[model samples]
Target: MALCTPLTNACKRATASVPSASATSVLKPCSSRWRRGNATVAPPVTQDATSSKGPTAMVFMNMGGPSTTDEVGDFLSRLFADADLIPLGRLQSYVGPLIARRRTPKIQKQYAEIGGGSPIRKWSEYQAAQMCMILDKTSPETAPHKPYVAFRYADPLTEEMYGKLIEDGFGAGKGGRAVAFTQYPQYSCSTTGSSLNELWKWRNRLEGKRATGEVDPEGSIKWSVIDRWPIHSGLVEASAQNIEKTLATYPKGRRDNVVLLFSAHSLPMSVVNRGDPYPAEVAATVYAVMQRLGMKHQYRLVWQSQVGPQPWLGAQTSDTVESLIKKGQTDLILIPIAFTSDHIETLYELDKEIIGEAEQEGVRRVESLNGNPVFIKALADIAKAHLQSGSACSPQMTLRCPGCVSERCLAQKEFFAGQAKHLSAFSQ
Candidate 1:
């Protein structure tokens, strides 16, 4: 989950793209060509007794970043232009590019601070490798679980992965199914929703190709998703392990003075009003991690990664840091609960900007969770568990928002309309 930052006014909401209805209406009646298309009928591919007819193309989905500094504008362009992010309707094509071009210089500086580009692709690829290794060992029945990275706005985009899957004979029974294993543990319409929607678009387009009698080379295409896993036991355990390890780094005496804070990307109130369940599910991850650590002193949860001047979830991290300073509490341990790896948001935003605030306030110590081995292992376990289970998603991993009332949940998907609900109204 990435945030629009001040360096770029990427958070400015454009008028909602689809008319007369919320984003939900655009997704309705489940009209994607992927779902409407026919399954490829092909000669049977022999499979070992333990193997499922096809290999698993597991793509770790994320909002990709530039590999080089110059490409940052391209990254920002795709991000700002996304209907999920800015919703500019027809004007998106015009203004979104302008927004990206305008923000480039400032955003470039931020990327430069973190070594020229986001390491998200690097980290996500490593995680995918680890997941493939685990899946190979633990679930031989689904052996040959080929791992790939799918970014919504950056390189190795979903469409790229889709073409590769079909080429490799994974489409429709060449013994392959695509798995969009979300990198988000907690669901959000902005993040996971955007990723899923894009993937669906690819499927819908592929449906057209098949209609032209372009047979799926090896097998029928199928999709399985592991979108929200906020409370997966493996994930909680890994987080607890990292928290325990990182906390010990602080002076023992100062440890008790420090607050264990969980920071997440913030969403606009308008997005939340549309029934985004991000904040609440994020809270669930924090609470679960807190429990695993067995902390008696209350921990904290705060939102970060806001951009532009629009309303966002709060107490904003900077504001929260200031409040803590005012209370004469400076020692802090920040766990980026929404991110699985260290990228711009963590390496620069939280580590520098936000922590710099604490330092300026005379806060003695601060730290963030970044690619802990345990966390990676837990992620592998989560994805592996999903594949071993027959359902599109593991039942245990579902974290639907409380009182989720979107018709799109049933209309567009059994899983994807899938964020925002049951939290206190947006406020600081």
Candidate 2:
């Protein structure tokens, strides 16, 4: 199948609005610098200066990781504090921190195993830069207004990033500004929703504190949010193609008999039972990729990296592997669909735990399609489409129909509203 292309006409129209001479003018260079233990220091751009138009703003969404062992407590506090993340009411106040503290040793150990810390923030920054490069190549007209920026839920970029962008003169009517959420091929409330809520809160705080002289006038620029891309066919095909490549590396005969295990992060059964479409969405993605591959190989969908005591979606990948081993299955191919890139879940849980189990179970070969180039290109394609079509500002369409309130949505709504009220009191 041919790769999907962005809306060219729309891009042309958007570009034509900017004058040729002005478009060719030298743009203020933006630089990002970081020190090992110090906050990032970016070269300051003159906020008062105006180019032909304003800068393009892009925010990459991420589930921020804990940077220091000491931060584990506060990190869990913020994550659990959000009702959307943990729908358990006031119980979360105590449970959230407790869980983080308990898991700190394990989590810290995992981070230690793969360097000294999680590279999510750094990877996100690199992705933003790569995305900017692609956007520039695809649409040079908007190249000057690089809309590339990274933000995290529990770390440095915080609400402060928004303020910085606004200070550097990015907002509505100033230039072509856009926000892009970074989860490719699949979307989950836990990842995407949490990041977006952070952005919303940051925007609200920055705009709210305007009276306190904390707001940047240039920041008042209009901006649009681009958050979701549901199971695009391009991504599906790319993933399947990547899997085929991985299969090729194995002994020829073993390839055909490989057990194709598609894995995703498991959510609590309460969430799924309540009507969250996460599981269904993940299924759809698996089906799409499987259909594209045209494979008759034995396959199963399994969940990995489950947390909290609440019942999570299953069959757990490790448990499933054990069952398959008993049934005489040997070769295996693990496809991590829940995550776009390798993280703690992928590096430790799936790689260390599951792979170790597979080896112990006598599985001869185990393969993974995590961070394959085709998959990365698929992500770049998704981002390019949004920018080229000027659709980055469009609201994400709901997977569920209106009035369709799955029991999950209803429960989640009630949970969120109550938490919102509670959080609101603290804000006031």
Candidate 3:
């Protein structure tokens, strides 16, 4: 959920690279080659031939980072070119690449520092697989939930993931159900919205394109979205547990006095001004976690990872940390509130850059929610509710931003919401 803001432009659709569909689509296990220390888990449950309704695809959606230094250039380029993100207008083709090229070295260095890559891919795959395993038992009607990771940028891009789904026998006239579960707990037009738009774009492009492989659009995968769940109780409990673990490191006398700084990636005020729901939803998560902790220590919601010289939503995290220390509030716990997994933002930026600069033993960051059993259970609970409810998407997803002028957003929303017609048919 690391967002980079640059010069702004009116929202318009941008072209994306078509992934090589010819590439073999064998599902790979979590690779130890990426320096991720987490142990590999078994794959998600497969479809049962005996079950009438099974083989559901649970696709985890997020803005992914490069897995290695070699991928930073293309990752940044795809990110900057996304109109749903940076929105560089007609110059997107020219400006996006230039910016990505310029920033590649620095971003690669950051990734290099954080165990040579982002561990998000590893955690996402593990979480998705684990959640599906729970779902197979808990929601057996939709048994055998297979996990897929769809990154907006980096490897396993939207196109690649969609192709894998087709290869896995999801679409191509053999109708099935798939859930686009956004990994961002709080929804943003720049984050989850962008990912959905990409998914919708490919859904149209890849399905029913040619006579040789024509897909009956009506017979394609029936889709539903778990768009946002910023305040799920399980999520709150997991976050509270992590905070408590961090607080225990402090001495008894000082534990209750330590300030809690809950930080999330900042958005450009331009997006904020467009009535994007992210800022409010992120606040909701912080509030819920604090309440679950019984509001013991003082806390402030802060923003981080604002790139370029634009007006971004703040009280920036770095400035707040420095100010708090100056005010003699050195005992602080910094929590990465919005993101569920560890990435450069947490590993390099918070660990090496911010806390490293502070040079205070009193300052500490709570561990990320990655592979947290409670958090993984929360994911399964959310999916189970969605599966049983037969809803196309959350009601909140139907409305577009007040300032949204992009036709892509409108079409994408309508397309997903329209799946309500198909959900009832499949649930039986």
The candidate scoring highest on lDDT is 3
Clash pairs for candidate 3: none
- Per-model TM-score on C-alpha atoms: 0.81, 0.73, 0.89
Locate the minimum summed-lDDT window of 10 residues in model 2: 1-10
- Which 10 consecutive residues of model 3 have the lowest summed lDDT? 7-16
**lDDT tens digits, residues 192-242, model 3?**
999999998788776643322443354467899999999998899999999
Cα deviation of 111 in candidate 2 (Å)?
A: 1.6
Off by over 4 Å in 2: 1-54, 67-74, 145-152, 172-176, 208-219, 360-373, 388-428
> Which 10-residue span in candidate 1 carries the lowest summed lDDT?
419-428
Query: Model 1 misses residue 251 by how many Å?
Result: 2.1
Give the winner by TM-score.
Answer: 3
lDDT of 1 by residue, 171-199 (tens): 44334455788888888877887787788
All models: lDDT? 0.65, 0.52, 0.80
